[model samples]
Target chain A: MASNSDQQSMDVNYIARLARMNLDALEARQFQTQMDGIVDYVRQLSELDVEGVEPTAHAAPIQNVFREDLAQPGLTQEQALANAPAQSGGQFIVPKIVE
Target chain B: MSAARYEAVIGLEVHVQLKTRSKMFCGCATSFGAEPNTNVCPVCLGYPGTMPVMNREAIRLTVLSGLMLGCRINPRSKFDRKSYFYPDMPKNYQITQYDQPLCLGGGVEIEGASGLATVPLTRIHLEEDVAKNMHFATCSGVDFNRAGSPLMEIVSEPAMHTPEQAVAYLQGLKQTLMYAGVSDCNLEEGNMRCDVNVSLRPVGATALGTKAELKNLNSFKSVLLALRAEIGRQEQLLREGGRVVQETRRWDVEAGATFLMRTKEDAHDYRYFPEPDLMPVVLSEQQIAEWARGLPETPRQRRARFASEYSLPEYDARVLAADKAVGDYFEAAARGSKAPKIVSNWVMTEMLRRLGETGQEIAAVQITPAALAELVELTEAGAINSNTARELFGELFANGGSPRALVEARGLAQVSDSGALQALVDQAIRENAKSAEDFRGGKAVALKFLTGQVMRLSRGKANPQLAAQLLEERLKK
Candidate 1:
């Protein structure tokens, strides 16, 4: 796959627009060069074909993972709100939620 | 209009939140009243480096729920990732059962009003709940409290031909889950939610007509009403020769209309793939046996038992078994009182009425099952007259007092003494001489008047039957 690089050219701005992203002219021209190189590098990964191999989606080999219906200790009010940027009494204070 | 020629095809997908102590795939607590997000952990929050380990309680509950619904348990099952884009979704993908569900090919039996029928269940799968999203005008807020909760999604085949069957099927399913101790099944608290697929076709068409996905029906009444309104909407379109569009719609309870939400997009494919993070869920035969043996009799079986045990009418049995609290109370009282119909009557008429008046569930009632049994005993032994019993019932319901104590403390017990009642009967007959003469002249209604006078003389404490008997005896003299 890496040897057969036909050097196909495409418009980067067109792809960005389709993805609902706005890019300036200078940024588009610069990204066009960078993305083409990245795509070319990823194309090399196709050469190692293991057609029957399964795609791994997660890390753990464990299945049917579950916990019993037993209550456990939970965070205390002090610990729960320890990292809050703003706190009032026992609650984390935020902007008004209701209209 | 010419005899309408249309058929209503209905299918239901019910989501029941399983009563588990922890999240489906994490150790976060699955409690409702916990502070928002307090029960959450790194796994439920979808932290980048964290991985999920399924909760055993969730699996056991799922299998227990499947067996309760008469579904065949799948020996081999696995989880999949259903990808979607929503702010409420912490991982932008949900771990759910696909291809191989926990149970399949099961059904429920729901009785039609005029006859009996059965609804076929398509499948029951286990899944994790998404966080709750509250969309505001300018921004959206997400509550992670509900995230990672264990949810069992049961889909029914589109076998129902009428809206009434649909509602019955839903109610039966709710009661069944409740009996299994798998869920509270509270619609008000969002423990159970429904999405209905409805379509209307020509009278004899073999193929299904276009379907509209009705979303988020909050209550059972709303489910029935939404289905009815949707049926009308589809039939009118078909009659006008207009093709109904395949789309999703929201049921506007206030407007009583199904408004178009969105057209069916490229089939959500969800790009579902087996979750590699989890392993295959294999249940041992011994494990299943234990669960099955410990399983209590379902609502349907218990309903039949109640019918035979109490010799109650089918309607009364249904009302009694509608809620687990009421059904358990009825059984408890029946064992102590040995009068099923008598207990059923009190529960249905007096107990249910008080529950309604207070806007509380039967479990919320202050009166204990023992108190209820005692109350029935008092009534059966003629310790309290029927009228006095009704008045005492209110006191017991309001203040939660013992029936015997209330009767004695208030002097509300019936005066069954023949001497005392006979004296009152004589006084009534002498005071109402015209009524006495009318009774002798074959005016049968005059006896009822004398009976009423005797009751008034005893201040509603007189045994009504004894008063009537003694009054008739005095009139004859």
Candidate 2:
């Protein structure tokens, strides 16, 4: 609900940290201005009457569209991991994630 | 303060894999235990330029499940992208229902210690299941066979206070879903999984306390054990004047303890947005009605019917109604016989015992419902004594055959011919003279001894009723 000027003062560094991204000082300033403009555009809708208006989730009017539950041939083991940067023993290898 | 003064608040989120033939959005087969990565497609693998098309059967099943649970199906629902990063999720974002779920506002009734308690449900949403991740000593493997399978996420209100109630609620939910044919709900095969949220508050407090989320609960028994351990841990901390932190805890099955996984601050910020590739689902009144008509009778309705129609005890009806396969089998067998209780007894005792010993499902049992009913009828008509019937049951259980034919082929039919039994009774009276005299001298146990002699002569095939009549008639003379 904050105005565009209020959003401009928002900390871009904190947001970047939450998103796990690193940004330099000039990039942070640039992102802050861009975010402020995006927030301002979304904020304009708040002035309109939303009472009794069901929110729209999709642009199309269709619902319940579905395909039959039929199985078709799919990729082989090699093709499945083809996009992986690292692979070992027919599996995609990533940095170890401790559980 | 004593731990007794504190009560636990519990809610569960259960993820059940629907029994659909294909993947939720692709043509890949949903069969389990297939070769790893064999079921993957470009759509499920999250490759560029791939669009998802919803599976109609999955939608029908979700609606049917909602109807069975007494939920209100939303006229309009759409999928959302829950953005996150996990090795199991190839797309790096899961297509789930965020604000507009398919079903809302339902409750499952569980039998608590006091009586029936209704555990209210918050919502039931449809989503695609992530792939399974397997960990080894040195490396981890991901299987895409389970990915894109139709998964239903059911969230419950924090209405349960004890572990027993939680387990009961789970059992009730599982029974309902199974009856509706929504899912198999098998725990070991990962068809169903549960995450538990629990917190303890003073007995009289109204506001809820900070709750801890327990994950990796594979079975109902594990859910109970994990809750007990988590509740104990919380109580001990509170009793020592410490505050319980709100965090996600991993339940270590081998260690039998809950360990800190992550705090609330470390939770994933799932930037949810509407899935643009798929269309919003709109349901017409006629479509809803059609789906409703196809739903099977609920477990509650079946239990009531079993009691009235079959004349079964309430306990028996409850047990039979808990599983649809068992209930259907009972009905099929009972329909052929007048004595339904007899059929119920066999199913509950001998049939169930055999199933347990052999580790076979009821559907896979050798004895069909009609065959079971025939055995019951033979016993009821006195063609075979109860003892011989039991022995025949063991044979029929081991190797399938008609009871009537088995009785005839094995010479197990009762010797009820009056002329044939008269000779056995005379022989028994001639051999055990002291027993005969004791019977005439008013010793009642001597009559039993004579009956045993008649049974021994006939090799346990003699009709004990006619033998007793013949013995009493000769004793009077």
Candidate 3:
């Protein structure tokens, strides 16, 4: 399993970039090997035949769980911004976004 | 090719914030302009391990809007996670209906230069709006009060050829949504925002040209102006042997031109997947039927009904049917009145003007429809002259009361009795003998002077027509 037989390598660099992660070259190489091993382990599902089965997002067979559209009191401005790393005038401040 | 040979093709994607009392997935108030971040909840704030519970009212209103626009309702719709790294979105990914939106095929019927046409719709999907980001000098502030509000994205097909049709289409969509009571659709208040994609192709070309997306067009005027400028720029570019590039341009309202909004970013690859926490919405036929029963008349249908039921002209019907509240007001005021045209005129002119000047909504006005109807009836029946009726109308519009009662209390009724009118006319002839002499000497202007005297003697209560008739009898002698 460590030697990796005829399977193509996973693009771990692209995946990390999509996740907004900064990986050093060594870390990228290491993650490629580990993620390939993980993918190989997950590929065991290919052995099963799922052609006729209906694709499902939820396995519990439960649907239409909704709450009434009634407003209950939420966090006050003080409580809401309490967790922010930065705050200004009861709002969370960040770097300017765009023009 | 001449500039006229190229036709502009435009399509709009409008985002409307649904008018619900609570957030889409949480029980936070959706009221606008509360203290910043006051409406925040764990679910909308994207706290870890928080699960979203769907708002049944948001779903109902979305389906109702679809029905009002003649869309086919999908029985089963699921939410998908769309990834965006923007800070405006508290969650890294947006929960939107991708392949299974609640509503499928509908069209907005717009009245254009060719009379009436339906701009075909691609789809309408329900999604959650993001937070409000206010950019300051050095830092941007994020307010989560707007997060998780149910927002509807209505995508129109690239079927419009001109900017006029595009504006009409957007107006029609907004009117229908407002009529359904789904969203307020107020452009100025950011209740509705639009993005348009435009391209120009030479006449008789089958394939489309490179399209440019125009953004930040908040108002209908901006939509029209931005589309025009984009179309003009593209046409001029193509005619001058340049190619139209595909990019995103934003409308600079100050400059009245479109400028490149952003540098081309990396290719968007939103790794969309099914949302696992919330379950799919499965509506039964009976449930959809119950909602369909509550669908209000669309703007087009309401306009047609106003024309037929009230016998209003086309222009009046169109103006009256523009707003559902105004149309409701007009209908209630003209329900049993014999003079609907007169009522329509007053509603269109006086009522709308006052509401506009005072920045008030039709529903918040002091005047009641019954009072307006009574006022119109009084003026029509000659119980009060037109001038007196108008004066009383302002009084009634400002201070709500019975028009008849107000007229009686103020002694403003017209003096149409023959005996009282004859006495007033005789007094006018005797006092203004010079004017009477001029009238007998074949001066028609002097006769008008005598009528004014009669009106003044009765304190503007004399019926001018009857007073003129009685004066003619006396002055002839």
Using DockQ as the measure, the top candidate is 2
* Candidates by DockQ, descending order: 2, 3, 1
lDDT comparing candidate 3 with the true structure: 0.89
lDDT of 2 by residue, A1-99 (tens): 112235545677777865678999999999989977887788888899999987776655666677889999999989898877867766666656676
Q: Across residues B1-477, which tens digit of lDDT does each residue of candidate 3 receive?
A: 554489888889999999999989999999997889999888999888999999999999989988888889999999999886888886799888888999998999888886878998888999999999989989899999999999999999999998889989988898899889888899999999999999988888979999999998988899999999999999899888898888889999999999986534664557788998889999999999998888788898889999999999989999999888899999999998999999999999999998988888998888999999999999889998877887887887788899999888889899999898988888888898899999899998998899999889988888888889889988887
Which CAPRI quality tier does the interface of model 3 achieve? acceptable
Indicate the residue-level lDDT of B347 in model 2.
Answer: 91
Residue B445, candidate 1: C-alpha displacement in angstroms:
2.0
Q: For residues B325-365, could you state the per-residue lDDT of candidate 1 as single tens digits?
A: 88998888787776678888989999998888888877767
- Top TM-score model: 2
List TM-score (chain A only) for every prediction: 0.47, 0.75, 0.85
Candidate 3: residue B138 Cα off by (Å) = 1.1
lDDT of 2 by residue, B2-85 (tens): 554799999999999999989999999999877778899998888779999999999899989889999999988889999777
Candidate 3 chain B: worst-modelled 10 consecutive residues by lDDT? B261-270
Which of 1 and 2 is ahead in DockQ?
Answer: 2
Candidates 1 and 3 compared by DockQ, better number:
3
Of models 1 and 3, which has the larger TM-score? Answer: 3
List pairs with backbone clashes in candidate 3.
none
